[model samples]
Target chain A: MSSGEIKALVFDVFGTVVDWRTSISRQAAEFGAKHGVTADWDKFADDWRAGYGAGMAKVNSGEDEWKIVDQIHRERLEVILDEYGFPNINDDELTEFNKAWHRLDGWPDATTGLTRLKSKFIISSLSNGNIALLTNMAKYANLPWDAVLSAELAGKYKRHPRAYTKTAELLGLEYDEVMLVAAHNDDLRGAIKAGLKAALVTRPDEFGDAKKPDLEPDPDFNYFAKDFHDLADQLGCD
Target chain B: MSSGEIKALVFDVFGTVVDWRTSISRQAAEFGAKHGVTADWDKFADDWRAGYGAGMAKVNSGEDEWKIVDQIHRERLEVILDEYGFPNINDDELTEFNKAWHRLDGWPDATTGLTRLKSKFIISSLSNGNIALLTNMAKYANLPWDAVLSAELAGKYKRHPRAYTKTAELLGLEYDEVMLVAAHNDDLRGAIKAGLKAALVTRPDEFGDAKKPDLEPDPDFNYFAKDFHDLADQLGCD
Candidate 1:
């Protein structure tokens, strides 16, 4: 299938469009310092995010009740804060700190690239994040989204077929007419399995410079680009 | 309640944010000219809209199955086209013409007013218009919406408690924290009945010069203004 057939581009927000690890790490560091604690904040960020997939898996597999990404993050954060040898923090302060995820700065190209992509096709967030989180993040980062769609609406998380398929249906498009754009190979694969086209946009710094990145695309992937700007160009969008 | 307690301002799109009469009449005139027909396009526009509320009522009341606003408009269009003596047109052209609702122009104060309001509160489209219609209209008219929450998502049409309450629920806010900004008194009353604050933003020209407008505000409404700009000023938005 050609890119011309793609009517909408649904994006994965966390590490694909926004540098979550770095953003989370910085905020984690500040919160730690305030509590007179110090630890590998990068590791703290990683540890917090590490539970995301497993948390969603529990819900998708029916082992746990449905909970939004914010709730998932908060549950993991409480455990991590104690692990870091921090003093007890008040619930209000912790709630504010948990919203650090909402304040992430987008990759430099995210805003402009999305603007160009929006000029040609409908662009929206197809994140595991809930609507409130995505809406807050868009304002925080100046992300230009045509609509803020979430797995919360489907009561399931990403990699679950329902999330991707439901988003396409909500946008009034056929599954094949919607393309999932993400930095993760597993996510693209999930979208493909769900009968949606996939584009792998590399974000080498997503996991920080030390770790190897998924720089190469799988054979079945529809498109691979260095970043959102490159993806826009490849898709023939101005 | 004070404006300070209103965390989000949800707009009623059709006659509130957009000048639907003008936009529909303009498009209808062009379609008539193409078909060698002449009629009062304003009356045609009015006739087209007169069915919208009743169409939705049928679904909300379970008298008819669920249908999006676009489908509702198309259903009414068929009846009116016959009355206007429109010659037989192909399905594709009819479908395109039905999208006249999607190409609506925002009121003169819409874009700028919404931008101002966005600085102080979350601004979203809380219309009965389906997600696709609202999304496309936002792009066509340059509406800066943080999210698009529709009655379709709630499986009910406006004036139904589900439509108003569900929108606040989706935005992750309490009913009282979300204010419904609308030109029609009944819609605002529905919102108030659902425990949400109401703002009556009058659009005197919404029905055109011949008819009376909803210029008076209900005594219980939290705020009243002449337009979106006036609403923004009343809300203390920069």
Candidate 2:
């Protein structure tokens, strides 16, 4: 009911806590230059991310076998590399580059804001990203998570109730005791539908200037704020 | 083959990171005084821990349903409490007392040593303890873990190959790239048998004066040290 009842804040990491678009675009541009190629890296970032939803959909629909986000991202990266006019990159180089997702930078307010929230509640990542990606990004970006949880643990991706429910089970908390703090309204709605509380922390720049951000929360959402700092403030976290 | 090859250091928490024996004994003594009951609290702690291995063996052997370590601990606590002649405890009090495991203090070298190790290697809790137990303990004791991994994730307890192999898989690292740093020789041997490198970091007083400690490492272990600090130095962590 109230934000005070929330024992934990499980975050959606990719576009919510970290600016995956900008980070991926920057890395893609550098990779392009190294191969003497040029293209819209922003579009490339979008295209790369486009595969994510579709990839998860296939698994959730039972049309494909269970595969982790890292594998999905790698599969997409291989296809995109060939399309972007790159030479045949060796397996080692591809493997290293595939970890660009692991090197993502958190939004400016992420570290300090999460620290403030951590003082008042157990904070963790509930991203669809695999544990390795979330773990590496936490270290790389200085994101202070008490635990790095993933849909990988549930053997399903988000929007699937199992992912949300399994996380609560793992943390030994009731569904309503955990709140999903995410920038995307869809993710928050998924949490609400799955019996967990929802907080929409807007990142208007999450999709960059081209796409319209979900700036306002739906009426049913428990809390709406501008960013992690705003959410911490609203939750009465010092 | 060497500590140099290790990318991640997964720790065995119970006896290695925390002085659980003393912590549990102190808590038990306090609870007993409140209830007008008395016993050798040290023995109580030992008796409480005694159920852990056998309980896990049942689950690992498919003789019992899978349960987290917290549930396992609670079951043991209930049996011990009755034996200690305690009166009826309300559900809330029993729940609070069961969380004594969560409030454990890190060994003298744990926090500082883990921080130093975290500087160079990805460090995590690879305990048979459940996710909630490990996460709460990390926060309570100021253990700076990059992530928390557990046997609960694999639905098997330590010395089970699945537990060790799944941890490496979750981290996206080769088995040899992740080393198990444990106070127990058998756990280190489990890591080795599962293809991971092993570090025997002794806790000479882990079981207190009544029990023999694992003071020596098997020759096959990749590294050996007296405590976490010594282990950090041997592993070239600053």
Candidate 3:
């Protein structure tokens, strides 16, 4: 694929750009320690993320009213805090603690790789995360994004065609002119179905041994790279 | 007014940071010259911009369906093109020409003042323009926006309470914590009425001799300055 045709690279932030599992687990473990609680933090992270799909599914299916990701996370947190056997926490404390998702750490290659890509293409987070979460994460992790985009803007979640197409439309580009770079084949498939180009960048440690990473791309994916730098190289980005 | 209370400074972009009147007039003049058509370019700019408020008002009032600023501009462009008696232009040419709004020139202090303000606050466009128009304008004019926000995301236009409130909501801020910085009192009044703080920054030459600019702030406004730099100074931005 010619690099000249690409106008923007919309990234799936949770896994592809940041080590969300590790970051969330570490923060959750710290919060647990402060409350004299202990459990498998990785499992905690996974459980928290597990709530994401169901919450978004309800909204996408029109079963639930439209809500921001922060609200969705907070609702899920209320359930998980009870399941994890945490003592009663005040609303203020819970609200602050729930912001752990806003402080995720970028992958080792994320900042540098995105910087390189930004030099050529407009780089943005196209996660299901709300605008505030992605914006705070960009600041916290020093991710240089030309813009911060999210499925929240579309009032839908990823895997929904509107999530992919709305992002392209927002950027004033033809669907194929924007490329979706993600660590998951499902997301790539969604982008492809929405008429956007797709590139898979494998993040082997994304699930922290609790889940299998999609280490290989489908035959139809335009490019696959082990890291952002590798992906930049493959895309011929300067 | 305490500067510390303002977490984000949302701007009215068209005639505030960008010299839209001059920029549009120049481009239109060039296009007219090429097409062998001659008319008052300043009047042309005013006519084009006059359509913007009416277009947005229709959306705000639910009298018309939601449409992006690009579509609004194109709709006006079609009417103005006929008024100027220009030769028939094809869709491709008209589309490219309609993007003139996306190539506005920044006021002399716009970039520097915004850069200073950005060091202290999240500075973003909160215009009736769509994200694509704002993003392209930022890239073209070198405006340093932390985010490109617009009424397009809110599904309403400015002066409507939802437009101001939704921007703050998306930024995860209380309405009072977000300040609207603009060249017009009417826009500032709308923001203040929506519970946001308002800062009026004068753009004396925004309309040249065609119309009088709102060079002074309404007495109820929280802050007033001669230009963006003056606003930055008043806000204590470095």
Candidate 4:
């Protein structure tokens, strides 16, 4: 498909747009130094992220009450700090440190490609991150979004049909008119399942040697590209 | 109050940031000329807006089911068109005409002043208009909103206390830390009653001689400025 009918591009922000692993690892290293603690910051970033899926699953499965990603991150942070043998950090410092997620730096092509896309179509974040997280990150990273939408608005996490469909509904577009751009095959597949168009943008460095990444698009995906700039060019974004 | 604690400034878009009356009237004039019709487009704009309160009131009072501002505007447009003696316009034409609300022009201080305030505080649109309308308007008017929030998110209309509080909650802020910057006293008061701080930014020409503008802030308002630039100045934005 030419993607001519696509009116909005809703992005998966975490690994697709921002280099979260490097960003988080860098921030965590400074945070560790402040507390006189040392460990593998990269693993710390990964371990913190490991709790994200299970945390959302608990809410999606009705095992726990509804909570924002910030809350989930904070709860997981407490466990990670204890496991890493960190000293007693006060609540204020912990609260400030938790906002490291909001201060992420975008991938090299993110802001420029999004600016080009914005000239032609609406661009927004369709992430599991809550509204506050997305808004703060947009400012911190200079991702110019026309809207900051989240799965939090749908009361579901990514891969949930409602999350994809609800984002389309909120943007006042038909499901197919809002394309989901992500680095993960599963997420693109989920968007296709929800009747939305899907574009697979490869982020080979997303895992940074920690694990293999989804460099190939699924058969059902509408478009496949190496980065956002390639996706923007294929989509005819000037 | 120093206004130093305020983290985000949520705006009332229609009249505060944009001169909707002039924008609608101008668009209506162009539309009327194409249809071989002529009338006081300003009055036509006013007549069209008269349905807004009743439309939102029906939903807020649970008399009618929820509807987006686009639907409400279209419903109101049909009546005004018939009243103005326009010929039977086709569904496609009417649908296109209905988007006039999304094409509003911002007031002179809007873009530049908002850019200034955005440097120091998170700026957002917290309007009764639906997310689609706000998003479209932001792109058209060049309003720099960090988040396009709306009363629709709360499932309530303006003047509803829940609308104010829910906006603050979504921003991950306490009510007192998110100030509502509006030209209308009633909207500012609504935000105040919901435990938010209120800033009254006078828009003296908002009504365009149709009605008196609110040049004076309520005694309880935390700040009053002549325009967004003044508000930015008072708040110590560089």
Candidate 5:
């Protein structure tokens, strides 16, 4: 569990590093305002995210074919726009709005903490987000990733062993040499099952009352922290 | 043709950025001195690189199964070691020597020029080098790549359309928005055929006296520069 043994730190982006719920809700609220429509922004964010997990799960289970997260978001947006009683939007407008996911605001500790961690380890995103989403998010949020990797590269979703192992293999490191840092216990557990190390980072407000955050860590988890800065401090990163 | 239109610039790494020939030759010369052996180091570098294109082509043509560049390099090293009359080399010893490619020395303009270009556009290595080789080289040579993309991801060799197209697709850029910057005309031509923009950055000393450098650009190339710094200048990178 020593820092010296760890070669890379792969992260789950949506809730771990970026505040997707707040960011998405805020963007949706703004879009709704411009269109003279008022509705529950939090509900919109949650509904959008619900589509993401369901879409990915279907792809993972082979019930649906492979489609990028962008496509999934677009598909759900079309459905939800009708449910919210919004006027019909053009394809161009819908496409630009769909890219709100790319412009997510980072968690308060994200940039500063990641800067500290970058001094010590090769930090990268191991999200289910496609490469384009992760890459664009890195640029938009100024997240200094040494690499932007995704489960799309492995043709599987997170929680799958291939996704975790493929990332380690691409980095040319042993599974134990890479650590998955995330806000979810399930993701950390999956990493551990795949022979990779894990660190639990709690994001208490991630779901905003709609869903419960995994605030506790497994006994076997290497580290647990309130945020990225706390994680940096615990890991001895500058 | 406009700088703003270029979303990503994919680089040819070996000689264009890292001086692999000189780096490998120097490392090999040092290894030779330690072992009390001597030969033309430049020829040694050429011989080592000679196996690379053919090895990748075999995989692309389905004549051989998919293999990473690390394996290709190792296979070449075994043949060259015996030809160069090295004696009593073990598996571990050969592996250590094979990683010389991973420890290449960057050209003087590489780091600064790339930094300048990166400020204006997404810059990544589109070399035939596997992810591990490119990642280790980035750390070793201090190349600031936005991403370390490789032909390894495409499961094909360069000069094949898939290699160039897959890189652009992975970056989520249109083919025309992604530019291939390389010293080799054939590589640029391949990229152009695949609908990507092409920039010819000439490295006159890439082949030394063993072969002629790509001193002339193809008529269809969008930009031509004397070196990486010149390329940056042409691209209007600050």
Candidate 6:
């Protein structure tokens, strides 16, 4: 470890470690029920999540200033609140409900697999989500991360080379020594391009009935696993 | 939990969470034995740590460029190496030795108390140490941190208003909701000046007979306790 290398296993949070789609959908349904607004709650989750990409893209492109994922979610939440017949929700309620992202449910393998991997590697989050959101979700989902790192710290979102390499730098690791475990192929590709190792942990239910998931990894990826447990097994974690 | 507040108990790592002086002194004695040189290892720890303030103050005052705590420690280690009769140590060996700070031993109450605090509030590290240093130290010391935050993230060292306020902002909490727990009154005062709550957790043996410890808190501080366990009890964490 003297060559500025502290081996780390950084993770992508949203769909890989946590089942955001189902978690948000379930919460949205309950939120809708309380407000007496009954639309397709799953679609609402989708629409709200859709803003995330555009929000990050704008910031990355210099079209907008940097904002945390919580603000991004709130921006999207407000748009869909009116569109989805949730106009009566007060500002305070809206603020509380926006944290639904921070209360996501981790996939069953997430916590235990991460714990196992953490025994050997410096395990942390490398998500586009802000640190606050990731930290809160880690506690809420019991995803025992050694550190809660995020694109917020790097000031860049996923798929950006800076986002991938900066996270490795923060862990005092060479890019090659840091492995990114994610559900998205593009994120893995981004990691590879940034000189970090990549492992795709597929989540087929990530999109629910909304969109298809990325089940295949690119040839450049170092490993591919059905879930975090399989990844941990491949990584030789007990 | 709404209203931009996620209550957190952020900690000052060095003397508050870990017994750095004794740990560094003990490691330095072993280092000296290997190098065939001997001196007051405790004094060496003190001298090496003394450079920390000068390093951060230079950067803070814009007289020197930004550098991490690791680099600061490295600079200090190199100077003390010559004065303490270990001039033959190579750069690689020096680098490894500098990381002794990253492997400091946690206080008896550090781990258990943090685990208890984590049960109710988000518990993280709020140190002047860099993210890598704090993260690695957390691993070495078996300390549980929800997030590894630092003055490095804010590009300001502790005792700076930005360092205190920025950490709270990163956690998506108001100043008052994020309490800074430290073994030093100056740090607690810094947090209070930044509008965050403060708690003083004394480490009477912090300096290893080198200097006096800060056992008393300011009148404005929210709490004072003997150790993390006492702090935990006072904070109402089960």
Which pairs in model 2 have colliding backbones?
none
Model 4 chain B: ten consecutive residues of lowest lDDT: B1-10
Q: State the lDDT of candidate 3 residue by residue for B1-238, as single tens digits.
A: 2233889999999898999999999999999999999999999999988888888878877899999989999999999899989999999889999999999999999999998998888878899988888887887888877777898888889889999999998999889999999999999999999999999888889889988999777888999899888888888877
Q: What digit string (tens of lDDT, one per residue) describes model 1 on residues A112-205?
A: 9999999899999999998888999999999999999988888888889899999988887889999999999999999999989999999989
lDDT of 2 by residue, A1-238 (tens): 2333789999999989999999999998998898898999999999899899999999999999999998899999999888888899998888888899999999999999999999999999999999999999999999989999999999889999999999998887889999999999999999999999999988888888768989889999999998888888899998
Model 2 RMSD, rounded to 1 decimal: 1.8
Chain B only, TM-score of each candidate: 0.97, 0.97, 0.97, 0.97, 0.96, 0.97
Correct interface contacts retained, every candidate? 0.81, 0.81, 0.52, 0.84, 0.48, 0.87
Tens-digit lDDT track of model 6 for A1-238:
4342438989999998999988999999999888888988788888899999999999999899999999999988888888876657777888889999999998988888899999999999999999889998988999888889999988988888999888888888788999899999888989899989999988999998779999988988988999978987887878
What tens-digit string does per-residue lDDT give for candidate 6 at B27-51?
A: 9999999989989989989999999
Model 2 C-alpha lDDT per residue in residues B1-238, reported as the tens digit of each score: 2334789999999999999999999999999999999899999999999999999999999999999889999999999899889999998899989999998999999999999999999999999999999989989999999999999999899999999999999998889999999999999999999999999988888898769989899999999998888988887777
lDDT per residue for candidate 5 within A62-162, as digits (tens), equals 99999999999999999999999899899879989999999999998899999899888888899999888888888788898877789989999989999
Quality class of the docking in candidate 2, CAPRI style: high
Clashing pairs in 5: none
**Cα misplacement distance, residue A19 of candidate 1 (Å):** 0.8
DockQ head-to-head 4 vs 6, winner: 4
> Which regions in candidate 4 have their CA more than 4 angstroms from the true location?
A1-4, B1-4
- Complex DockQ, candidate 2: 0.89
- For A87-190, candidate 4 gives per-residue lDDT tens digits of 98999889889999999999999999899989999999999999999999999999999999999999999898999999988888889899999999999999
Query: What's the true lDDT of residue B108 in model 5?
Result: 89
DockQ for model 1 equals 0.81
Structure candidate 3, residue pairs in collision: none
User: Higher lDDT: candidate 2 or 6?
Assistant: 2
